[model samples]
Target: MRKFFLAVSLVLTSFSVFAVNSSHCPHSCPSGTPSSNFVVFRAPYTLSNNATTKFADWVAYRIAPDTIQGGRSRNFRADPLLFSSRTLEPDDYTGAHAQIGTDRGHQAPLASLGAFSDFQALNYLSNITPQASGLNQGPWNILESRVRGLVQGGGFNEVFVQTGPLYEFFFAELPGANERHTVPSGYWKVIYTNVNGNIQTAAFIMEQTTPRSSNFCFHQVTIDEVEARAGLNLFPNLSGASTVERRTGFLRNDLGC
Candidate 1:
């Protein structure tokens, strides 16, 4: 078991390094941060409405930040138009106007963030994704909800998320744009926690826009894989955990998540 785990870990680690080094960014912005695993492009010039017509209460922004394995963090600023003296509805949005066929998908869901301050920061357009309706509301939403639930349930307080689509074909086209941008066929999310003398991290990868299927049918990969792809380690201290059992056991016993 020990030998098998070590071999698997080495393979994953190698792949991460290779993927990061090999990936290229053709259309990334000049000021944006680019990596093989992901790219942080500049936000749209204007704010748009939420994708779901169910709500129209929030505004958006664009930001760029460093990407770490299991998550990404950016210096986000909220739109003044969306703020209210009272709690704003998460589903509420102004309407999809500026960008045609581009749905204003929330990087941080309204349900997950209730505090006015938190919502204010998360509603920025930089964090939003121009995703398909099915992909935005389906598995992507589910995964966001799950992560929020975990945080609320004391899984972790300081959690960062960086997510985007993985276009399957090199020349695949976006749903509603004249120029083609990379359409993600899969999505990646990393979660990390430090609570009560415990430290834990998790990574999830799911199909981007599969219809009628569970939105977050994810496959777990090693922390090394995540770190390599994201180019930053989540648990820098746990470098010795070479096996899944060792890594997960440590999480269960320490973080209790």
Candidate 2:
């Protein structure tokens, strides 16, 4: 009887790990990701960690109205599933804020799933990037909040978000980081959700130098543009063949453009 129970527990554990929301990735996770990257599944999200960059190549999550939680925490730590050398420690950002005006920015965003018990998984270093304070705390934050607002305001049943760093150029190094890694030149985010029977997407890219007072809508771009810059084909399963869908300006009405 004990053996049977143990076997059942193992099966349940495996199922739980694989059961992280399928909608989080839309039809599938980004393809053409670097071969060095490995996928990590958490309760609230899934991420592909780049071994070379020591940061997530992309973090995909779903935000439902009820999942939006109040309050936040900062218990950043290394992902235990990843090799110690392949992930950053909390110390990596010790003096980063004061020295470089950067923050341990979260790709999955605590604000998206703060109400859940596994919300801390968003704090894992593998899911973080050294985003500039102006970008991380300002426009970047505004974008995150707005994404949550879409669901909380009852506009959508769920919102899917995929975000990652863009190494267009190397940025400053962390004061406490011991591993060799490239800081991002910028960051990109692609948000999508189902409306009626159609799918809508809004993508944006922001640099570390983006003005704190600037509007996030001003930085919006096509999914193709983000794919070209980041080298990952996002939302590949989405129907159609338009490689580059550029908008003259932010035109997604639901996204408040």
Candidate 3:
């Protein structure tokens, strides 16, 4: 049950977007799978592997009321789910420490997963990209925290989140040997939510750079745009899920700006 979409009926609006059962889903492209270039891992949350990129192609999860808070210190480690040695290990990011100005930017943010076990799952190298200090701590961090606040105050029936990085190219002449890995030029996150009967989806993109202030790197995008950029279907099963995509952000309420 934790691995795939819920088997029970998820009546979003009229017809079910997700299949009645994960076994017989109508979607041509589900979150993750074995046949594709990415391998799927469902440790309660969904993480799809992209061994060629040495990171996750996407990480998806459904957030509920209980996801707002979880008390635990970060325990960074390698992903045990990945089978191929070609995938990155924790050691690959040793040079990406905060002291070096690059961060092991989490694609599936730990704050959103709050629970200790779920949070720990995010520490996998597959869930991270080499992000600059500014973007990691600035707009991106603020956006993650604000989402928690929104879910806490409001009553959202279901929230599906998919996050991953966007690769442009690789540069061997970067700062360190670790930098030789495929560094993403930007990152994207898409959030699907059902509130009271109406559904809304928010998408965002940010460059991999350090920001001096919050919201500086926030580029509001649409689900279609992200689909084109990420080269993957976020919710292929959704069919014509909804056109209520936003360009600005996933932030339901403003944190500061």
Candidate 4:
């Protein structure tokens, strides 16, 4: 078991390194502080910790038609699981210059998890970030709606969505008193589906500042780009994960719907 775990870890890291365009960090991203692997899995999604940045390294969830049947509206709040000292509060984004220019963006959106508690859980501060007003309400939102449609319309047996933020090497601060909170320069989403015995994946990234609003496919990229930029090695427990073929384009007409 020990050796097996070790081997799996090696393959997972190799996937992060080998799949990326460089053995070194990307142009603007730096490894100033390594992220945490403290993972917590819940009804809506699973997230790995990045306490230094006070956000999840990544948040992944599986959505199906039944998942969005019903949910109650709830307000965003701090994650009680994290210590108060290290967690973000409602005030963090409030007041002058604070979250003015940005929106309290959802990494894994609330609507994706329609059950009462899970829906509310998506509002936890650990899952929130400051997103550019335009990006959040514009192209980013349009694609999110499209993804939800694809699932709720029975587009696939199941769709797994993983999302998270990315920061430049030095990172940026939220405009308020909570300077500890980092403002992501960009965000990413990866969708995976298995239909008719075929596995298909589509991954994308867009700057929080100037994401394209007209075309979703314009930003589509290989999963390699997403993982490398965030410095995360996802799904190490899956043995064949490393062998999955990485593709740069979406299979629209060929998606075997």
**Predictions: Cα RMSD each:** 15.2, 5.1, 7.0, 8.2
**Could you tell me every candidate's TM-score relative to the true structure?**
0.47, 0.87, 0.75, 0.76
Question: What tens-digit string does per-residue lDDT give for candidate 1 at 147-182?
Answer: 555545544444444343333443233334332233
Q: Candidates sorted by TM-score, descending order?
A: 2, 4, 3, 1
Candidate 2 on 1-257: residue-level lDDT in tens?
A: 54554354345334532322355786677776655456676678888777688888888988997788868787888876777767888877889999988988888888789887888877888888998988888989998888887887647889888998898876789988888888889999988777785666789999999988888888988888998999987766666626324532432666566
Which residue runs does candidate 3 get wrong by more than 4 Å? Answer: 1-36, 98-100, 116-118, 169-180, 214-218, 245-257
Q: Which ten residues in a row have the lowest lDDT in candidate 3?
A: 5-14
Clashes of 2: 0
Candidate 3 C-alpha error for residue 35, in Å: 4.5
Candidate rank order under lDDT: 2, 4, 3, 1
Q: Number of clashes in every candidate structure?
A: 20, 0, 3, 0
Evaluated with TM-score, which candidate comes out highest? 2
lDDT of 4 by residue, 1-257 (tens): 54554354345334433322111111111221242333444567766556667777677777777676445564889875565554588877775234356777888777766654457778888778877777888878877766777676546656777788888643346655454656678888877676765666777788866644646667787777777777765433333554542565554433222
Cα deviation of 51, candidate 4, in Å = 1.2
**Candidates' C-alpha lDDT:** 0.38, 0.78, 0.59, 0.63
True-structure Cα RMSD, model 4: 8.2
What is the TM-score of candidate 2?
0.87
